[model samples]
Target: MNSKTKDAIQIILVILSILMLLYSIIYLVNYYSENDILTHFPSNKKSEDTDLLTPNEIGDSIGGVLNPIIGITGSILTFLAFYIQYKANKEQRKFFYIGLNNEKQNRIDESNKNIDLEKKHHITNLKIFKSLVSSMLNYYISSSQNIKDFLESEEAKPLGIHLFIFKTDSSYEYFNKLDFKNIYDSIVYSFQNKNEDWENDFIKILNILNFYEKLLAEMKNTYKIHSQSKAEKLNKVGESITQEIGYVLSDNELKNFDGIVEFLEIVYNSNPDNTPVLPEDQFKGTDFERLQDEFFNKYLEKLHMRYNETANEKYKSQLDKFSFMNKKIGVEKFQTVAYTKHLREVYENNFINQTNFDKVQEFLNKINIS
Candidate 1:
């Protein structure tokens, strides 16, 4: 039963016991007084009725009154003692019940705590995955900046004027980046574990990852990119550049980049100089192709490392799986925000998701995604 119900029952039992005990005590006192159980000072049993002249009648009447009081009192005491004993037994039973109930509740509470811990880590780990993705993408785009300008200037897009800054490895910048990653991971882990001090950080990371995911998906769609072929489609996204036939094609529009090179070499060998055939880039010319390749490879390497790194960090403990998952959740959420703000802007505006925009605002309150 519930605490309130148990308390009410206990109260009723105590009251009944007290009443019975009081009745027993009162009855016993009256019975004894009437009987005159003063052992040392004995009462005279012989009675003299001066007017009626019947001593026996007087004594019989007195005895009749005393005997009933004595009997009633004894019965009351017996009943009272039994009732009180019953109440005490009831109390012990109730105590046992409470202990059992508390044990059950404690188990449930611990389980819930374990569940919460897992959720927290999952979120954080997800965020980490996204961050790695973002880092790879950023590296590729930034690395290709000079090549983009060169290609465009060669009249592919036709503007010599560039508008973006060139940023190399500044010690401070590298330090700041490392610090940010560490802090982000720490917060995610702490929140998942329900560390009281990290409550605010946990909430912040959650909003961050959600925003990053929305950004990346929207951006990818906006670019209208398609894979090279049916076979290529099934390949991991990171391997896009190394595949012989790429979606990004040259001018002759040959499916395979290597095919273009081989064909050109064959023609050149046949006719040394009669409008010589060109390699892939000159024919289907993209200036940044070579540079893009370098960064793209790095990006793939980064993505592959995630599986190994995360598994190792988790220690592959079944007992700690929940904690690991909770970290992932946080990471995923953070990644959403990072991608949305950083990468997607190149093509479209998807700062917030359609379904969760309102909730996103509520979670982050007022902050710049950029």
Candidate 2:
């Protein structure tokens, strides 16, 4: 039964016991009086002898009334003692209940305190994770400025001399006359060599590797997480870092960066759940193929979203051709030539207005994916 019910029953029993005890005391007192145990001071004395009155006898009779009063007062005092004991027991029971409730409340407060502490821990972890990701991306991009310029330059285009070196082009007079192979090789060597400007970038990469090593060890040792949501955010940071690592590794100039790809793969393979949402191998690209699919996908997704509402058939056709060339070009060729050609055609045909073309071009340049 519940505590309340048990307490009520105990109280009823105590009251009943007190009433029965009082009733029994009163019954015994009446029985003793009826038996006349105090009928005479001496049991052998008779009523006739006591009938003769004297001055001393009259004084004794007056004093006898006080005897009954004293007996009644004694009985009242005995009942009062029992009532006081019952009250004391009731107070003790109340104290016990209060203590029990306080104990429960204390436990609840302790649990809430633990939850708050854990929440703070998760928040701190998320902040650190975010900082690491931003720092890594910033450092890697800064270090890759030379490679970015190479990719965006006009000389890197499909028909440019730099690309034609690998193609079966008959017009090779400029290259033979200038001995451009040694010149280009020297340029590539200088770009790959670490200068003072790249010192901080190398440090950042090392720090990123160290952080991942520690994080992996921690996850292996501990099964508990303060917050699953924060853990998921950490995974996103990992993915971003992975993409930056791929971008650096894919560059022809930076391809010789030692062990970076392997280190990233180790961390990524260790936690499959946190790996980048890229194709089978992100860094396995040829020529001007961009390994950073995240940027391209972001632009493509936005493109579809923006045009889906307008139901623009020309834009749809262009998006389809881009998709087809993406697969055909694989990792060896740049899509800029084909993509720019298609945009030019669309503009000349007035398929898209000037505002839409400007918007699309701005987005392409913003993401550096065009």
Candidate 3:
């Protein structure tokens, strides 16, 4: 039975026991008063009332009535004592279960805390690795002569040189004189044979590029997991409070108050749109290609300006070609203001030291690929 029912039964049994005791007391009082026991006392021994029994007989008569009532009362009292003990034991068991549940919850919370701490440590290590990869990429891009030769070759068709001298018949002589075909053939032979220093450098650069792609993917995944965990914890907190109070705090507002989102953005190097600033897919053409494109484009721009100032007939066809390509490609692609502002902060705060900062910045500036 339920505790409430058991309690009610116990109370009823206690009341019945009290009433039985009171009945027994009243019965004895009436028996003595009605029988006039004083009439049979030693002081009135000379009385010849044969109907009055001896004192011993009256005692036996009282015992006959009281004995059964006493046994019944004692049984009720005994049962009441055992029932009270059982209730005490039940209450103790209830408290024991409560304590057990509380201990289990504490253990679960401790495990969660350790897991969160481990994730944070992992994220920090990934950030360091990412920075190292970026530095290595910058170093290779700036120093690799194989990449430079490839850019200038006819096969690569360095964008600036192509625009300046290969667009029209009038400038074909300048392109032919550069002997880019021979340069292209030599680069191809060396790459295929893998016997040149430039070839080795090229392979190393490719390896670094591949590593960078994987690193970016891993970093993005880790950051996403960490951010989601924080969001879930915040949601849990919101759920624990009253709905009216929870509604007063918007999700974004709650995140702002915690500062976790902002901290994650900074740590993960994300743009304001929540996209990673240096996205994994960003290196599809490779940073080297972007660098080559930017370099040649700048070269053509300067050449065009020089030709305009000098009014030289010798440069007329080339400048015309430069103008057409410049117009076609659009100068807007060359604007690096946004990249410079964002990356400057990123490098200063997280990735690059002052020693490597200029090289990294220069590499970033030359990239036009979105």
Q: Write the per-residue lDDT of candidate 3 for residues 63-158, one digit (tens) a residue.
A: 898889978998998999998998899899999999999999899999999967755554444343334445555443332332234223412422
lDDT of 2 at 105: 89
Each prediction's TM-score versus the true structure? 0.31, 0.27, 0.37
| Residue pairs with backbone atoms closer than 3 Å in model 3 (clashes) | none
Rank by lDDT, highest first: 3, 2, 1
Question: What's the CA error at residue 356 for candidate 3, in Å?
Answer: 21
- lDDT against the true structure, per candidate, is 0.42, 0.42, 0.48
The candidate with the higher lDDT, 1 or 2, is 2
Considering every candidate listed, which one attains the maximal TM-score? Answer: 3
- Rank the models by TM-score, top first: 3, 1, 2
Q: Residues 8-106, candidate 2: write the lDDT tens digits.
A: 755665565566556656654553354344352324444553433443553465346444554555565565567567766877988999999999889
**Model 2 alpha-carbon drift over 4 Å, by segment:** 1-64, 137-146, 152-370
| Model 2 pairs in collision | none
